[model samples]
Target chain A: MVKHCSVFRDKTELEQGVAKMAELRQRFKKVVLKDRTDYYNTELPSVLELGNMLDIAYSTLIGALAREESRGAHTRTDFPKRNDEKWMQHTLVTKKDDTFSLSYKDVSFTKYEPTERKY
Target chain B: MKIDLKIRRFNPTTKNGREPYYQAYSIEASEGMTVLEALMSIAAAQDPTLSFRRSCRSSICGSCAIKINGFTKLACSTQIIPEHEKAHEMVLEPIANHTVLKDLIVDFDPFWKKLDKVKPYLMPPETQPEGRTKEVHISEKDAEAIDHAQKCIMCGSCNSECNALEIEKKYLGPAALAKAWRFVGDVREEGGRKRLGRLSDDHGIWDCVRCVHCVEYCPKGVEPLTAIERLRSRAIQEGIKDNHGAKHVEAMVNSVKKVGRLDEAAMTFKTLGLLRSLGMIPFGLKMEMHGKMPHPHLFPQIKKIDEVRTIYAEIKRKNKNAKKKPKG
Candidate 1:
């Protein structure tokens, strides 16, 4: 998941990560805790956290796949230029009623406009 | 290479952890795999029940302090592969001098309490001049004094390995004392004398036995024993010398000053004073009976006593108005 959503990512990497994450979520249902006792029950919580991580990972992969431009850490080798015409917004992932949704909101430039980043 | 990890696990509800027993797990060793990675992998695949505390995987978090082969170390930094030995004989357990709440997790309440007693945070000045808010400008050299101390992530590694804490729980452990010195060494602080007075009380700064366990085992290289020594010297310099520790230090210095060697009898009397020295009469009689007591008058006079005084005079002249630099 990390390699797919790394510093240099593309459409194929995002799609592969999204598919692998879906498989991971399905497999995570069978995972069981060896220690079910309540005293410091990290075993149960850890499994749940892993499930949550898979969900987040899936959402991130989808968001990266949907956005077709290079921006910040989500730089793509295929789309190397920042596309302000179509992709100038914030990617927000939401979960409701057991379903995951990916959407974007327009960034408000109240103080400073988004200019070309220079070293 | 395959490595066998013997981890001491404890869970209040389980039979295997009723008395805290070791559980062995054999895992295929990979290059550059840390002990923390090995434990997490084992818990995920092999057992799914083994418990330990870890985070960051970097040394900054300081949450992975565990006993590995009788030494407290951060598991995230310690590699699973042995450097010299063929198979890394791994034994993981919780650090000592703390209440073991569960598997590899100790109760940090006592440790946090000690830190609170030391007042770790820098205090704001009592009065500020009208309308001119400015930064306390300290030189780079001045800030270098506490650079190592500032790197402490509160791992509790020093507190775990402290021998004084093993003997006397009331004694302020190394981490807290070092923290006390951090503020005391800062030139910006306004209350150095008051801080030293409080630290000089019972089970405080004077209680450290100079075991140097804190110095040797501190993972961050924060030599807390050196800080404790500095605090001791600062306490003496500020004239808070009524306690037994300061009196004993003074007695030794005075002996070294007057004669070329230590006058044991005079030093003892001065340090312990009348009432405490009277309690030592039985021990003195025993020493006398065994003919082991070296009488002060019987010792030969040294002709080179002037040389010792000259060295002392030079040191005094050099540090005529020194406050930060300790006197010997």
Candidate 2:
């Protein structure tokens, strides 16, 4: 799954990653039964952890989809330029009710601000 | 590439519950994949019931500590490539000295209890006098001294494999003493003298056996044994040297200086004093009967006794100079 997530090059790849995560999440819920395992506040530890992993994976995919410019370690074959004006702020993704909500938060700039990657 | 991971599995609710056993699963390995990433793969695809504790896969949370091939390490930080390079089969076990709740999950209550002994939090800074408000600032050098100790995430990896804790259950293990050093080294703590006094009490810094297991196993570079030694030195410097542990160390050093070797009788007499040593005569006689006691009368001087004395003298001179130098 992580290998599949890493091969994300464009919007379509990220969407596929999200779909894969959603399928994995559903299978995890069905396979890990609650009756046999120990419960803390009506949730099995394994199921809870799987949910957390799914949340993290889905949010990462959503972040990759929103950031149009190729910046930092993320390389987008479609959008190859660093668009500082539009994609300068940090991308924050929150999943609520099976929906990934995207929001932009201001970057706290110190002395060093974003610049063109010389490499 | 595929590697076989033999994981120790336990489920308390099973028919033959509470009996721990190993179960092997073949998982695909990729470049830059950690042991933790592989475990997650097994958990997701092979068995959703597989359990482990983890947060902050970057290794900051310190929750993913476990034993790989009998060595303590954080699972997330340890790469599977090296283990795969060594052999086709890999072993996974929960860390030693911690009670396992289930597969890969151990109870952290004992670890946290030991940490609570150090008074982990700092005492509140005194309020500004009247209308005079002055900002408190720490120099870069002072902060640097305690910087290494501050990196500890209380992962319990060091405490798990500690040999001293194996023998002395009540001992304030490495992680706690490292935490003590963090507070004691802070310049802002006005009650540092009092804190050192508390640390010198029973089951404190003196209890550490200096096995270096904590130093060897700490996932972070928090050298806990070194921190314990620092705490011991602070105790000695603050004139809080009433305990037998400190006296025993001082006695051993003095005996070595005098006889060019450890004079066990003299060390015992100095550490235990007259009455206690006299009372321990029968015990010493028993040790002699068991052939464990060294012959008291035959104290062999080292071939380089003069060289040893010279080294000691040089160290003392350097320490005296260090004490006399003005503090920045």
Per-candidate local distance difference test: 0.84, 0.81
Put down candidate 2 lDDT per residue, A36-80, tens digits, no spaces.
Answer: 555221236655766788888878877887788788677777788
Worst 10 residues of 1 chain A by lDDT: A33-42
* DockQ result, candidate 1: 0.71
- In model 1, pairs of residues that clash are none
| lDDT (Cα, tens digit) per residue for candidate 1, span B183-269 | 988867767888899999998888888888888888889899888888898899899998999998888787777877778887778
lDDT by residue for model 2 over B260-312, one digit each (tens)?
A: 88888778888888999899999999998998777657887768788878989
Off by over 4 Å in 1: B83-88, B129-134, B298-303, B323-328
Q: Tell me the TM-score of candidate 1's A chain.
A: 0.90
State the displacement of the C-alpha of residue B41, model 2, in Å, after optimal TM-score superposition.
1.6
Residue B25 deviation, candidate 2, in Å? 3.0
lDDT agreement of model 2 with the native: 0.81
